[model samples]
Target: MTPPPPAEPVAAMVRPASRYRDSKVNRDLLGVMKGTSIGYWALLGLCVLMVHVAGGIWVYQVYKGLGIAGYAHPVFWGAYIVTFVFWVGIAHAGTLISAILFLFRAKWRNSINRSAEAMTVFAVLTAAQFLGIHVGRMWKSYFILPYPNQRGLWINFKSPLMWDTFAISTYATISIVFLFIGLIPDLAIARDRARGFRKGLYAALSLGWQGTTNQWKAHNRTVLHLSGLATPLVLSVHSVVSWDFAVAIVPGWHSTIFAPYFVAGAIFSGFAMVLTVMIPVRRIFRLEAYITDYHFENMSRFILLTSIIVGYAYLAEFWTAWYSGVEAEQSAFWLRAFGPYWISSWVMIIFNGVLPHILWFKKVRTHVPTLFVLSVCINIGMWFERYVIIISGLSREYVPAVWGTFTISWAELGIVGGSFAFFSMFFLIFLKLFPIIAIAEVKEIAIHERAHAEEGAH
Candidate 1:
């Protein structure tokens, strides 16, 4: 038969860079976008219920008084302020992972940066609520803004509170813009695959993107510029927050070290919150291939580094207090370590400082359950850190007569719980509405990997 007419040489199959096919990627991710599990609905309903409870509590407080909560003499800044600082600190991790890491060209960030950036935006929103709540007169909260009004009133530019107003609003605005900008290509992907109202929603949100080369080029440039702008804001926002205390003349509050100390703790807690959110997300979405052990390992290392920094800050605070020879400062430091709130102080140390050392072990770093539990502990510890710094500093003034004890009330606890629910609710809604992963970016990485593989194959 003439050797089957000299059959043509079989073509070699080209392997894709990533294990996933583009169509499969779209299908898998779109599966996340399209449907909701009963569990998801149940969790969302629970969050909504908690949020309503919080709102009702806030309304009750508004009608009754701030006294219903825990605002008393010497402890004017209570659970609300502590929650605000904690949430604001939690916001820092997203910017650090997304903007700072992006600027450094960390490829590993591609998997988690989308969620981190979203967390930053929503955490800031959650943090903002406390400002109004703490002010007690939510209606008069607008007075903090500088505007041309019939009555001549202006924001005090020199006040740290004023600076915080600018800092947080600026951070929120820039973060939202950065998030929206980064999301365009993925939004386009969603737009292409979706139908009905979903298609139109994504189409509008995508801002007329057509995936042209020019569009990508412009998108990249904008991202770079925004990242540069955002990186400094991350440092500045928390620094300004620290100033809210550092500028005061309280025994523990006034210190030059507060800025860096607060910044480090912010990043520390922020990473913990990231871990808290991402571990469950990765599990639920069945995205183990995308969010692999490598990412968790790197994050654990980051947590370890921040833990060391925070521990140093803690020691430095004591050293500074002792070194300064200021009796009030010394008394404040002693009280923090051994006073009535000693349990909280030690809890902060154990959780933020000691427990994170477990991440130094490779096995612990790679273990998701351990990491999740550690992250939750870190979050709790960070909250207590804020409580120690704010309430402790304020409670023990030089005047012994004015010294008082503060306790969180049921209303405050309800509000705090509600804030968690609000944050979770918004994040869940985001997952439902958008691609949790950056489809274009992930595909781009895959293409680069494939190119390298093909070159090596030759």
Candidate 2:
């Protein structure tokens, strides 16, 4: 007997299977499009209000010089410096998960990669904002660049700030490229699904993609290429960021281990932010099917692994300090754990290093509420990690005369709070305006999953 004809195509089983219009994610996104949610509008307003508050303080700083925010004779770096490093550290997660996981072929990451990429973009924005704010002479900030000055001087590549400028700019550019590369297929789907202005906008963004074999092949190749290029840059970006501190002669700042340590911490915190943003968003968008528990569990495993690595780094630093018998190193470590910044130090240890072990239990790992709470704790803990490193380390330097406490002013608080609002508002708007999930990737995965199930049954 002749072999039975092949079963109906998966695409044929679901009419309009290739388009976003056929996707549950698309439908939910369309729901968000009808009108802005009250929460999102509230966040936007709050962010704007905070920006004004920060702007008012910034005006005072401009006129009165940098002393207004409490940088004293001894303390050159203060809350602004601490927050700048913290935000940059927090910015690491999305790109880490997306680029690293993608390279490793972690199928689980596919579900959350779109949101994670978006997070990377937003986190970088927050970091950039801190940079702008931290620079007191904001108007003449371009003076840092290696351009023709009034004296026609050249920028020294040896400068840490120059390295930072290069690294951050490179990283941000790569991040945006990676994000847009992944978004292209989704944009095509959005173009096919949308109407009127939305349709026109997505159509232009889609860049004439019709899902032809050649387009798919080229797009996939480009994504792979960019992801490969981005993976090393991700590590280098934060490593170079850490150099801004490590290159310094300051007692607490100079350490050979800082590059890897900071990169790990950045990845850990970045993942935490991704989860913090995604948990609520996944629920609101009704993307439970696409972003399944399996993905969350896999992500949790990474969180657990990273948490352990960071904990070890903490121990290693202490060990080196003890072994070296360096007075300043011992002082820095002791001050962090037992000094004025002790609360933040202990909080970091308990929340980031200790608490994440809860993931070892499958029940807690899969539970949404627990995961959400844990993500928030992880974020708080990561912030404290930065706090402990910056404030504790800086406040008790070798010269007791220069040692001073760092206090956060309202302006700094407002700006940081506004950054959160800024990230959330952009994400909320993104969900409505674009497909939240990678529609093509999900459809492809779903097809593969069904095929595997069918084969298993046979």
Candidate 3:
């Protein structure tokens, strides 16, 4: 019997298979690539303009010097470093959803993993730019690369910063390959549906995906192996990032708990960011045919779980500081609460710790508009978490006289804005070029669903 008609994305999966079909899935997913409204073009143009403006700011700073962007005194790591960590942290949820959940056989990841993987790759790419930005000499930024240079500069093997270079490089390479592999089957679908130049492009990129049984076997094996390979990165990438601060003898950052704290926080922020981008994309592309509230509910639950972990880590930081009775650590924590940047501290606490508890109510979790707002709050709070950890900690350290405030400049704020624009520009470009939802995986799930439906019909 033919499927009746499409329902909600989640409902479509479980509803009598009569309500959906493979044609619907392919039509809906592929439809995203076939249109470009004035609004989307405008948005993309806006992002590009902002990015160029940011580049101009960078150039101006280069001309004047690093001092123009507020890398002064104790607070050497300004907005660029803060944004660097934020992007790196947000990149994790992609691997978590695509890799870790895949390993665990969590089928809920089926619809969302494609977009999450894209986010991961783009977020990490955005983060990589900051290494050069933070160094203030974009030309010499390649020095952070692992290879020995012609100028006789060998990499510093001992530094956690050095570990960051390897972690980012390794993670980005693997993630891009993983994302590309997942896209092949879908590319083949698009190839068959396309014509002219588009046909030729997809034909080449699809790499002869004839969808034979042998090809399916190879694809599944490859995905399973890549899933195994990527799972550890969910934990390791951010842990290595945390080491950049933890290994240092800095008072607020030198805790043993930093790794887990950072990892949990990363997942929390990462999920929120996924929501932030996903909601708009879903609405804009009419993807509600696939990205339904069931997916949103699951993601909210993840946010709720990680929020609790992150909140506990917040309390635990203060507890450990107080228990250790170290003046520097204790004072740093105190100042974080009561010092000049106390507002950022409280924002992190309320937005990250307090607000997400509302997700305990299923109504809130499944509500799309409310989830979008909450996700934005989480991203902002997470940014402040990094800001508090870096700036607030560095601003008031051991010596009273040497400690100076790191006031943000227009250039710094502009670059932060630009980083977001850069990420958005790439993501906008990607939406037109690729299926944001996994077409092949969704069809597989639909087949499983139809099998159960047939059994029930008996």
Candidate 4:
């Protein structure tokens, strides 16, 4: 048997130790090797100011009513629903990057896995806040749960809201667990370097991590298990979120394609949000070496591929409407393309599904400024896509008498603003407290790639 193909090469199984593990505190924080910049401080202050203004607006909404949000007769969902869906779409990227990429063994994901995972946690919090504010009777929102209430009614599992509660809760819990598990080894690193209260906090979080063989084995097993659990959740949570619209009988809302369509859109937009947040952060933290052009290019390639998928979904929806010859569906499709909400529809097409194609060029994808600009546009386009789907679709129905325009009042806009502010604040705090990049994973990948190269050379 030709000596069993030369014993399959020892280098194929394990890599040599790395210099990264030997580096000191300032030396090892590759992502934040450079100190925080002036821009970061500016962004934080701006975020705080915006949040204060937004909080004031929310208070105004409480004083008034849901009607203050432009929810006239038939347009009950308006901008809050649009923002809700938009934030949910934004939340998809973290799981996709961390769980999906980890499963696929995507090497380029090394640079982004930690920040992207954090984004998932923060985005979920942001989306949850919007839901809390959107539900006018916030305290009574508990009625949607299965707890014994004054009405003596259990949860309506049949309701999309209950499904959403389940999906979002599962998503948030899984994401947090995955994030903390990934942080343990890094926390131990911090614990070694820190003093006083920081040391205590890091030590407690680290759970006595000593980088032993068993600890590393257990850590890897835990990560593998969490990734397995989160993979299905990435699909199920978004599908359940889509059910909020798909299960409804409204003309535009009742579509068989909503589940997959919403999922595709979520991923497309979520990737955009990840890029939007990460680009500035990488720059602020001077993480150019860690988050390289290669990673950005890979991310852009994903964006381009997903943009095509979203475009295909868009075409399929219209084709089905025309093929079925359903007047309500046909009219809903037409209204999206040519009616009052057509602007948002067109913007969604041009920005989310179209503009990302520019990334197919190496120059565009690798260039920081271009990618940053495109990401911002894609994010805006995605928000408008949600607005078009929720508000425009709900604004009109079979009866013209109930047809009305959906407009966003300042209060509703403020809540959306506050959501961003809250998410940013949480993420900023997390960055200071934890390693913004998965140092252990990155080092592992780096070693693996090096070993693979040496083996190939042999």
Candidate 5:
């Protein structure tokens, strides 16, 4: 009897039928939904502190009026406009990744597009903030909008600034919608993994996704359509932003090359910013398996491509000025290259045009430390490029009699630092709340691989 009793039942391994044949994807991505890293908390706290300090500085500037911004006569658009353009350029990489690369069926984008799209939204919001700050009266900022109000004002549809308002808003709306659509299934996965308050939030955001065949079909179709719609915006939005300068009667600002030149520069800097942010994210989050050296190499190739184009643009600017026989254009550019802002011009040329050549070497492109340093250098140079473009042109202009030097005020500098921190803060929160990698897309790659293997066996 004791021997019979000892023959207890062996536990059966009853895995669920609907479960993914490979569950590692879910385990790896969903693991991030729980637990906060100490490093993450430290970084988040630092960003929040920086943001608060920036906010206080902005308040002081607001209270004191535009005088505190260190704006001289003709140099009205100084750091504020430079910072604005820098962020607008920052926003371009996302649209390029999510929309253009998707059209080309670039699978490398799958690992990075989620974060790229989020970056675009945050950058747009940051850039919009400067418009108000630049206006000097945050209260009357609504005047920038095109709406007809009770105060007998007509919308100037012809204004290039208005064009900026339309382009950026539309770009933001589409980007948010595109990001949300992509997030649905990923949120559902997070919802199932999360508990308590986060569970409820994800469940609502995921909209009851059950991974039905019809739901997937709809998602694929919708993504394709939206990708097509977003494709043109990549070029148009930045072209309109360039018009803000090109349409101006400013000497160096008015050039036919401005549109393509600005677009190339935008993507050049945007890709650099992406690399800068993602390299840190990849290291911190342990996403090397997803965001491998392969992805980084491909991104570096783009940096090289855009950099060559940008360098050509630099030479072309001087060429056009010399060839066109326009004294104003020649003078503005001369001042840019050889005048007081020569430091920024050389920094822009050397950092953006010269340094990117290192990416031509496979070893440098694939090397993490070198790539990261190059990215940071590219960012600094891009900032300096805008500085030279705006301040250099505005510094000497056609009338040297009205010329004045624009110093980078502490308030302006603080706000720029804060903008970076602000973007980092939201991105940090996003890492915890959502699946940083697109789980569904990655698993689809696995499923296809398995199916091909099985078919080959058969």
Candidate 6:
């Protein structure tokens, strides 16, 4: 009789969905949406101030002319071009990790994909700024676009710049769409929890998403289609970027291997950037449970793999230069290692090629502090890599008389600093506004784990 009485409540017999919904992971992540701290505001203000400094420098340069920013005879493509290529390369890691890994069903990516995708979008935006700065006449920059004009001048279809324009624009558009599609379900969650204008905004962004089985099925199909489309862009955008240099007949630039070389370098720096951004984010947001040591180790392994590829590309370049018996090519390669910009070239080799091997040690990979420092060094090395490629190639051309050296002026330095500030500003704002981690995906994982636990109990 007592046993029968205790069997009373069906609610107690079956677990309520809320039990799974209010998981520790869900609660912890949702807490980030609550409000920001003083540190966030302080960092945001510092970023804004840095951006203003950059804007002031740009204003001064525009008024004072391009002379103020260190443009010269042979080295016209100085820091701006290097920074552009570096940022473009940085953009690759995001799409590769988010879209390609998604298509492969790499479950580990679920923790960091949102942040990586956001980084992709912002990096592209930052990279676009360099094009305007490099144009000198920023006002007439729109001329690069393919449109019917009164002057009857059209963009050259055969030009690599035209290809770059198309590739970057298309990649940015698809990336934005892919990022938004993934955000919809999470937006719905935010919409439900928020109040006032914030709620309405998220509601609009979420597009009336009600979590039904059919809706989820459609969502899954859409994601698969987008992922399939984005995967090639991950490869093509950076490869096309490499072609900007590769198509050139310059001794250092023209090589059949440049495409893969640039692609590998892009991935190398991109993962470094992800580590730079995510390490701090995971700590600040207390996302340790979600973005665990395991995630960091996985990324470290990726960094190690890309490092090896890049190292091979470097050796291959040297081998090609020496084996071809082309005096100019050999000279360019040797000059890169031991010429005027020798310091920068060796720095690139040591930081990008050699330093990352430290990640092979499990302790370095697992320790956040060590990984962060290594990641920063890798990014620095990557920038130097671009510098060596652009400056070294043009600095000592076949005709040494026409060759010249370039130094980055204060204005250009400000712009480079500003680009970093801008990227950080946007990413920080994104962290505060959106669920930085994917809540719905975390819930799905929790549900899967719980189901497995029940099966084991049986």
- RMSD (Å) per prediction: 4.9, 4.1, 6.6, 6.4, 4.8, 3.3
Candidate 6 residue 13 Cα shift, in angstroms, is: 19
- Candidate 2 lDDT over 136-155, as tens digits, reads 68897787788887787888
TM-score of 6: 0.95
Worst 10 residues of 6 by lDDT: 1-10
Pairs clashing in candidate 2? 93-270, 93-271
Backbone clash count for every predicted candidate, in the order shown: 0, 2, 2, 0, 0, 0
lDDT of 6 at 89: 94
Q: Model 6, range 223-342, lDDT digits (tens) per residue? A: 898889888888899889999999999998999899989999999999999999999988887888899999999999999999999998999999999999999999999998988899
**lDDT (C-alpha, whole model) for all candidates:** 0.91, 0.78, 0.91, 0.82, 0.88, 0.90
Candidate 4 residue-wise lDDT, 1-458, digit = tens = 45555565766656544523555323556336235667667777787888888878877777787888777877787777777778778878888888888889887887788888898888887787777677778777777667877777687788899899999988989999988999898888777767788889989999989999999999888888898899889888889988998899887778888888888888888888888888987876668878888888888888898899888888887888788798988998899999998989999989977788888889899898999899999889988888888887788888888888877787777778877888898787787778988887777876777899999999
**Residue-level error in angstroms, candidate 6, position 288:** 0.6
Query: How much RMSD separates candidate 6 from the native structure?
Result: 3.3
For residue 286, give model 1's deviation from the true position in Å: 0.5
Cα lDDT of model 5 overall?
A: 0.88
Structural similarity to truth (TM-score) of each candidate: 0.95, 0.91, 0.93, 0.91, 0.94, 0.95
Q: What is the lDDT of residue 5 in candidate 6?
A: 47
Off by over 4 Å in 4: 1-21, 24-39, 447-458
432 Cα displacement, candidate 5 (Å): 0.8
